[model samples]
Target: MASFAVLLRAVNIGPGLRVSSADLRGAADDAGLADARTLLNSGNLVVTPGSSGAGSAADVARLVEERLAERVGQDVSAVGLSAEQLDAIAAANPFPAAARDDPSHLQVHVPFGDLDEAGIARLDLASPGREMLATAAGVLYVHYVDGIGRSKLTPKVIDRAVGAPTTARNWNTITKLRAACAGLASR
Candidate 1:
């Protein structure tokens, strides 16, 4: 079975679904994903596909949604990315200096599906405030010099701009996920 990184959207935020990482791990294990592991609380999970014919991103997303909704008592949707995909995203980061110097300042909003160009063009890239870098891999690398809270480029804004369901994670989380993927690959 191949290793997959599953990113759940709109979970553990505000007053929404509050499933803990530990509980999520149990839920994933119960859902038949081998050696399920979670990082932090933003719903980043690394799992091995357990079924005989299951490794696709769409398959993993369906499995997570089905099991997590039953186990956590709420609708939880996810997007699956392979270990190599995660590593490629890390390597394609446009603002490496910003990520290295100020990880908190550099953030990424990744779509669970293909991003349409017409939707992405809605973003005002020429705006004087924040900077957004789009890669061919469909990940947006953003840097807000004044911090995320102070910037207008929210997750909602990105979702609107890209017109795709997405989840946001900081540079630190991205790097850690890459490392986690590497660790899983070695196993």
Candidate 2:
């Protein structure tokens, strides 16, 4: 069995993408994922694929999206990370100091694929002061020294610049994900 950290996009924030943890767990069980559990209301799930119909990381992500559509009546999408990948992502934190000292100001922008240097440059220019952007390990760590609210590095800018599906997690969430998926690495 393989463990995966599944991150669903746009969930539980408002009326448009409402979903409960119980509903998510039920749908995951139906999709042949064992030990399915959610981390928070934002749709962070960790599941181990059962001994049947298991496939690659992308395949499981598709399965989750499909099962969510079928059972939850919502076409929820997500990003999947293997245990090892999660390890790399956490280890590659360029702003460890910020993560420790000012966690709320640190944001990790995990893109589906690698982002070019030009995009990173653009993102750097977007912030006028007290902002740092580090592009590493298929992720971008944005350090907003003045807090995210004051920065103009919006998700729209990230998506347009990276030209891919990207979901961001704060330092707190990233650490939580690492802790939540630690069991997979130990196995």
Candidate 3:
């Protein structure tokens, strides 16, 4: 069974749609995913396909989304990446200094669809702070030099600029999730 990281978009950000980590694990279990684990309450899940076995990361994502929708009664979009993909993302980090010195300021945005160059250009033009953007392997790496809270690079702006729905995890969280995926693979 291959390991995968399933990232749910826009969850637990408000009172409207709140999905607990336990509920996420339960959804994965119900979906026949084995060794399901969740990191933080922001919908980061690591799991392996059960005895039935799933096809690609997309297949795993669909199964999890279906089960989670059944449990939560809301459609939560998920982006799944294989263990190797997660490792590649980590390896593709362009702002290593930011990740090491100010990990919280570094964010990795995983897009659900293809990233548009025009949208990326728009994002660069819209940046009013000392934010830096880089793209590698279809993933966007952003370093909020002025910190995220004060920055104008909100989720809406990112989604609109990238022309795709995306979920972002800080550098710290990315490392943790990568470790979780590695652990699942080793077992």
How do all models score by TM-score? 0.90, 0.90, 0.95
Give the clashing pairs for model 1.
none
RMSD of each: 1.8, 1.9, 1.2
Candidate 2, residues 133-166: lDDT per residue as tens digits? 8887777888889888767777787777776768
Q: Give all candidates' CA lDDT scores.
A: 0.78, 0.78, 0.89
The lowest-lDDT stretch of 10 consecutive residues in candidate 2 is: 51-60
**Backbone clashes under 3 angstroms, per model:** 0, 0, 0
Q: Candidate 3's residue-wise lDDT over 1-187, tens digit each?
A: 4899999999998776888899899999998999999998999999999853687889889998998999999999999999989889888888889989999999999998998867887778777788999888678899999889988899888888888989999999989988998899998
Backbone steric clashes in candidate 3, count: 0
Quickly count the clashes in candidate 1. Answer: 0
What order do you get sorting by TM-score, best first? 3, 1, 2
TM-score of candidate 1 against the unseen true structure: 0.90
What candidate 3 gets wrong by more than 4 Å, as runs, is none
Per-residue lDDT, model 1, residue 91, is: 77
